[model samples]
Target: MGGGSFIEEVRMLGQGSTSSSWKWWAVIGGLVALPMCLCAFCMVSGLGVALLGTVGLMAGEVRPAREVAEQFLSALRDERWEDAYARCAPSFQGQLGGPEELARRHGGDRRPVEWSFSRWSVEVKNGVRQAHLEGTLTTASGEKYAFSIELRTRAVGSGEAWEIHAFTMD
Candidate 1:
C-alpha cells in the first residue's frame, strides 16, 4: 500500500511540473511582447500627432509673411510687448530699442484696439522679398487710423522667417 501511494505522488508531481512549465512560458512570452507592443503604440501615436499638425498648417493661408503680420498685430492688441518685439526684424528691433521701450511707447492711449488688413502687395527690395499689408485700426479712444506694415524674410536658425520690417500708422 505504501509503495502504491509513493507512485501516485510521483505521477501527481510530474503533472504539476508540466502545468508550471506552461505558466512560465506564458510569463516569458508576455514579458518579451509587452515592450514591442508599447513601442508600436508610441510610434503610431507620434505619427498621428505629426500628421494632424501638418494638416493644421496646410489648412491656413501658407503665407509666412501674412502670418507674421497678423501675429504682430495680435500681439500688440493683446499688449504682449515681448511677443510683438520678437516678431520684428533686427533692424526694426534696433529702431524700437527693446521690448520695454516698445511697451512704453505703445501703451495706454496710443495702443491699438482692433485692426485688420485690407490689401496685400509683394515686392523685392535690395534682393529681399517683402510683403506690404495695408490695414485699419481703432485706438482705445475709438479713433480709427489707417496703417501699413512691411514684412521681410530674414535668416533665422538656418531657415528663412518673415519678420516685421516696418510698421507705419497714418
Candidate 2:
C-alpha cells in the first residue's frame, strides 16, 4: 500500500504538471540539492576554522620563554620603550620604574647604536620555565658591550606564558 500510494501521488503530480514545469522543477531541484549544499557548507566552515587555528598558533599568543626573551630584545632594538618595558614581569615592573623612565633613558641620544641576539639558554628553575639570552649591543661612539636578559613563564588563562624578569642591559 505504501509503494502504491507513492506511485499514485507521482502520477497525479505528473498529470497536473504545468507546461513550463518551472515551479515543479524548482521544487525537485531543491530537494536534490539541499543535502549537498549543507555538506559543502560544513566542509568549508571546518576548513576555515582549521586555518584560523593554525594562524593563531603561529602568532604565539601563548608564548614560551625563549620566544618572549627574543621579542623583548627586538622591542629594545626598535627603541619601542613602552613595548619593551611592558614585557617585564609584574614583580620586575615595580623595580624598572615606568615606561616614561624607559623612554627617557633609552630614547634620544642614549638609544643603542645597534643590538642583536647573541645566544640563548632555556631551562626549568624550581619548576618555573626560564630563558637566558645574551644580546650584543653597540653604541654610536664605537663602544661594544654585552647585555643579557632573563625571562620566565607566569600564569595566564591561555596557559604557558613568558615575560621579561630582569636584565643587565640598562
Q: What's the CA RMSD of model 1 in angstroms? A: 12.4
Q: What is the lDDT of residue 9 in candidate 1?
A: 49
Q: Per-candidate RMSD vs. true structure?
A: 12.4, 10.5
Instruction: Name the top TM-score candidate.
Output: 1
Clash number by candidate, in order: 0, 0
Q: Pairing residues by index, what is the TM-score of model 1?
A: 0.60
Q: Could you give candidate 2's per-residue lDDT for residues 1-170 as a string of tens digits?
A: 25577546555565755554565566678888998999999999999999999767644432466567667666766788788898999787888788877767656655666777767667777998777778777754556778888888887897867788887754
User: Cα lDDT of model 2 overall?
Assistant: 0.72
Weakest ten-residue segment in model 2 by summed lDDT: 57-66
